[model samples]
Target chain A: MSAQRRAQVLLAILAVALIVLPFVSGSYVLSVATLILFFAFTGQAWNVMMGFAGQLSLGHSLYVGLGAYAAAGLFFHYGIGPWAGVWLAIALCVVAGAVIGFLAFRFGISGVYFALLTIAFAEFTRIGFDHITWLGGAAGLFIKVEQRDTWDLLNLRGTPKMFYFVMLALAAGAFAFCTWLLRSRAGYYWQAIREDEDAAQALGINTFRWKMLAVVISAAMTGVAGVFYAFYYNNLFPEQTYHISRSIEIILGPIIGGLGTLFGPILGAAVLTILADSITEIMAAAGIEVPGVKQVFYGLCLLVVIMFLPNGIWPAIARRLGLKDK
Target chain B: MSAVNGSPILEVRELDLYYGDAQALDGVTLAASEGEIVAIVGSNGAGKSSLIRTIAGIETQRRGMVRFRGQDIGGLPSHRVCELGIGQVPEGRQVFPSLTVRENLEMGAMLRRARARLAQTLEEIFELFPRLKERERQPAGTLSGGEQQMLAIGRCLMGQPELVMFDEPSLGLAPTIVQEVFHTIRRLHERGLTIILVEQNVAVSLKLAQSAYVLENGRIAMNGTGAELLADDRVRQAYLGL
Candidate 1:
């Protein structure tokens, strides 16, 4: 079979396996799978800006936090469902992305400077939310538990199985969206801009518009992930949700997988999440109270990956599987 | 003021460009008519590249007007200039290295007008540079310097630009490869395309050009027909080793 055909077959098999997972796995495994899919979705979103457009944003949690706050706040106070509230979350995140994009691109603030700007915005928002009592301030906010024996898909107060399927659907959607984008005209332009900004401009690609589009689209996608985070966890705290560490978690999947490839983020997230979870379980079973063991393990994994597989684990895997030529 | 045909297709009037506090171009004025080959011959740092860059809107000029097809396009951005039918083969053959040769050509035809004729233009470009066609599937960075230059010119042609500017097309190439590049430029000119060529190889550029200007110290030092400048004493003393 052709490389493309082989990839299609592999992806189909993976999808089938994921679909049948809940039938065989217990609740704990289902929840871990959901977490892995969540990271995959957010990592794909982050890849649009960093991997494709070559813009590094270390403060992506700004969008996630804003999105979670928007949906949870609306649902808590106004009795609005998450389905309707997601629009508000998307809007807020897009605006925030636009503001940052405009200021950064217009003034030629790029590279680490642009990353610093994103961090500053997220930090400012976190501090601002801390003092705002209307949204529970720093004390945290919770979604009221309703007595629903049946699945609640609309309000997103569903069972673990329901949430698992929802996350899988979302991961699939994000994957499809990224695949489509990489083949489209905008994708070509993004690749050109990412390779050389000045050359792209000479070829009649408005770099500013394309870069801003990447930021806005990435923010919007991450916003949707934020909505899922709020509804799935049923709680939000400014520190926990908007933290820089949360942004780091979102990016690590893509970085460890492969930045530009479609399957990189998903593979990276799976490897990271499963490994970390197993390590925790192993330590727990041994009754060894090791502090920051997961962090140390992640750091070591990242180091080994960077040292050996510089482009990421997915590209190496793809090459080995004959899914890609190089 | 001397236009080959009627009105000039591209006209630069007293363009002054700067990089920070340092002046890169000072009162450099020139023009190229439709279907004419105009060469800017100069030594290193003579502002030949800067002149074309300002015309292509890659560099902003502090003062003066860049009129393309009779429109004032001085302060416009590079992409806008490209949209207005001006394309540039930048220095160092900046073909998207990671992209395939076909994809690089496709990127050149990104504008609405060029995109409409993409298929026809791609065929034409492949016919002109068959080496590019042979390596269409390979990444552009893998191509040799001569092939890369051909790819760059072919990519610019894919844009269907009325006016194309080449900056140092022969730079860092062997004598035989430079000859091939110049031959390609001649063929392009013979096909009725307006060209603005900037080069340090004065003799070869002047031979290919109809009308040529000598740029020195960010200023136009002299202007004349190719044969006239070739025979001039000042040109022989400064550019050609007499």
Candidate 2:
């Protein structure tokens, strides 16, 4: 293996670190770990479209919000467990994904226009959900607190360690899935469409169908992350769930880690989670808390990543470790 | 006319195509038979590209028919058209830049063929373009213009297409590489595969073509056997620069 490929192997080994992390850390540390795993999942989900398929979606929060709402509503009222709720959320997200994909790919919207369409869909859903009360208006809804250590696994309620392990498993699964897809024939078409849509189409790529698959996959994955998000936070609100800020949070990991690289989202999540925790702790200790600090931090990180290492940090770190795919 | 024994591989009749408000091809009619190398030569903006694009189903035709293997294909999508054993190496070497040489070729065989058949096709492509095999892992964008053109042709050939359309395959290549591309075309021609070569390199095309058509402003300006066109004083003055 070349230096770069050796680095990817190292990354796969880093999964061991994640499994061991929760045991060594206190509640605060585990909290941060959970956040990292959550965002890493979101990042991988976002990478499905923005990285592999080259479709920029600045409104991924729509899927998250829809998933959270669908799952939470079912669990709260219909007595549905998260396992069933998750599938329902995915189906709903797929329908939404197809609609959005149709509008963007079929109508030939790309780049900034495509980004705008995603944002519009997200914002519209947020407002509409805020008004729809059968689930719960924007006031938000909380889960019924079960007996501590009663540990309802079916309901996705359990020990913090349980949640930690589940999230880790999910993050790993997503990474594997995206990596395999990239190496597959479908991945070839996605990359081709990403690089040049017209060229891909002329090569008989069937750009529309392939792009729709990207959207559906990304949306479905994001929807799964939404279920996890709802369960972890024990709450759901349309405004918070579907907000543009949430969309930014979802993409931050892949953007920082490495776009289109399997390990990039995990790496990006680790960096951002650590940085966000430190920055927040420092500001609180200094008693000079600024409004929207996380947003500002994300913006700064994006700028720095773009200017410093535009391809993301994975290739550089992978280079040092002697892992080159080619 | 004797090329296919009876049936033409592709036939377009009074096809009209428009781009937005501009008429790109106006009532154009053309045909190509199996086992023939048909050349369409025209100056820039002469609708040569549009003619093939219409036949390939990339551009929608407003009037008339595009019959490929006796089926009216004017309404079909490009991918469907491709799956019917007709593949187009579109204008410019649109090699997927991010894809490795091998991956680019693999994607070319993505239609209905199994991996085993595709593997066989890859062997043939490697035999045709050894440089591609040597640089299998390299990104196609980094290749030289000549190599990129060869990769494009090799990629389309990976589809095992019976009827292939090459648009400006000789563009922006060194003279030596241009001859090499023509030789490959000749080899395919000899294998009984039908080919439509849209080229501005009139001499090389005329040398290889059995029949030739001149597209001017989306209309057929002249059509005849290669020998007949070569002998015409008007063709010699305009295209051959006699």
Candidate 3:
């Protein structure tokens, strides 16, 4: 069989396994799977900007925070459903992305400087959100829990299994969307700009416009992930949602799996989530109290990956499986 | 220089470019008419690259006019200049290293006019440089220097440019490869493509070009027909090493 066909068959098998997982597994396992899909979705969104466009952003939590706050704020005050609130979330994030892109690109602040600028914006938003009484400020905001026993897909009040399925569908949708984008003209332009901006510009690509498009799309997707976070957890804390550490969590999947490839974020999220959960479970059973052990583990994994497989695990695995040409 | 009529396709008048306070190009003036291969030959740091880059809109000229087909295009971005039918094979053959050869050519045909004829252009480019066709699936960075140069030229041509600028096309290559590059340039010129070639290889560039300009210290030192400049004592002593 051809490498592409082999890959498709492998994906089909994996899809079947995931679909069957909730039926065979218990509640805890279902929850873990949901977490994995959540990270995968967010990581894919981040990858579009960083991996595809070569724009580093260390303040992605800004979008998540904005998205969560927009949805939760609207739902709390105006009794709006998250479905309606997500539009506002997307708009807010796109505007934020545009402003940041304009400032960074116009002033020629790139590389680490651009990254720091993103962090600064996130930090500023966090501080502002902490003081905004309309959104509950530093105290945190909570959504009213519904007492309905039946599944309410419209209101998003349902059992953990329902949530798991919703997350799975979202992850799958994101994967398909990214795949389509990677095959499109915009995708080629993004990759070319990523490789060398000057060459891309000389070849008639408007670098500023394309880079801004990447930022806007990526932010919008991350905002959707934030809406999921708000509705699933039913609460939003400015400190927690906008934390730099939370941003790091969103990107870990793509970094660990592979930066530019299609399946990297999905595989990375699965590997990181499962391993971290298992490690936590093992430590808990052994009567060990480790604070931030997962963070330390992530750092170790990143260090090892950088030292060994610089392109991340997915490329190497794909090569070994004969799925990618050298 | 022999008097040739009709408006120049590309005209740069009193262009002054600066990198901070250091002036890279000082009031440099040159023009190229249609169906002419104009050569700009100078030693290292003579602002030949700067002149072409300014004309292509890569560098913003603070005090000058760059007119392409009678449209003033000074200070327009590089992409806009390209959209106006000016393509450049930049210095060092800056191909998108991670992209495959086919994808690199596709990027060259990104503008609307070129994209409309993408398939035909691809076939033509492949015919012009068969090595690109053989390595169509290979990443561009893996190609040899001569192959990369050829790919760069082929890519620029894919844009269907009215005028193509080559910046040091023979910068670092074997003598035979350099000859091959000049031969390709000659073939392109014979097909009636206007070209502006920047080179340090004075003799070869003069032989290939109809008219030539000599730039020294960010200024136009001399301008004449190719034979006139080649016979000039100052040109022979300074650039030709005669």
List the global CA lDDT of all models.
Answer: 0.91, 0.86, 0.91
Where does model 1 sit among the CAPRI classes?
Answer: medium
* Candidate 1: true interface contacts recovered: 0.80
Which 10 residues in a row give candidate 3 chain B its minimum summed lDDT?
B1-10
Choose 1 or 3, whichever is better by TM-score: 3
Among all windows of 10 consecutive residues in model 3 chain A, the one with the lowest summed lDDT is A147-156
Residue-by-residue lDDT tens digits, candidate 2, A118-202 = 9999999989988888878888878776655757778988878888888888888998888899888778788888877766766
Query: DockQ for all models, in order?
Result: 0.75, 0.54, 0.74
State interface RMSD in Å for all models: 0.9, 1.4, 1.0
Where does candidate 1 clash, by residue pair? none
> Would you list the clashing residue pairs of candidate 3?
none
Record all residue pairs in model 2 with backbone atoms less than 3 Å apart, i.e. clashing.
A3-A322, A3-A323, A3-A324, A4-A322, A4-A323, A4-A324, A5-A323, A5-A324, A6-A323, A7-A323
Tens-digit lDDT string for candidate 3 (B1-242):
42374688988899999988989899988889898999999999989888888888778987989999899999998889999899999888989898999989989999987889999999999999999999999999999999999999998999999999999999899999999999999999999899999999999999888889999989999998888899999999998889
Worst 10 residues of 1 chain B by lDDT: B1-10
Candidate 2 chain B — worst ten consecutive residues by lDDT sum? Answer: B1-10
Which of the CAPRI classes, incorrect, acceptable, medium or high, describes model 3? Answer: medium
What's the i-RMS for candidate 2 in angstroms?
A: 1.4
Model 2 chain A lowest lDDT segment of ten: A317-326
Q: Candidates ranked by DockQ, best first?
A: 1, 3, 2
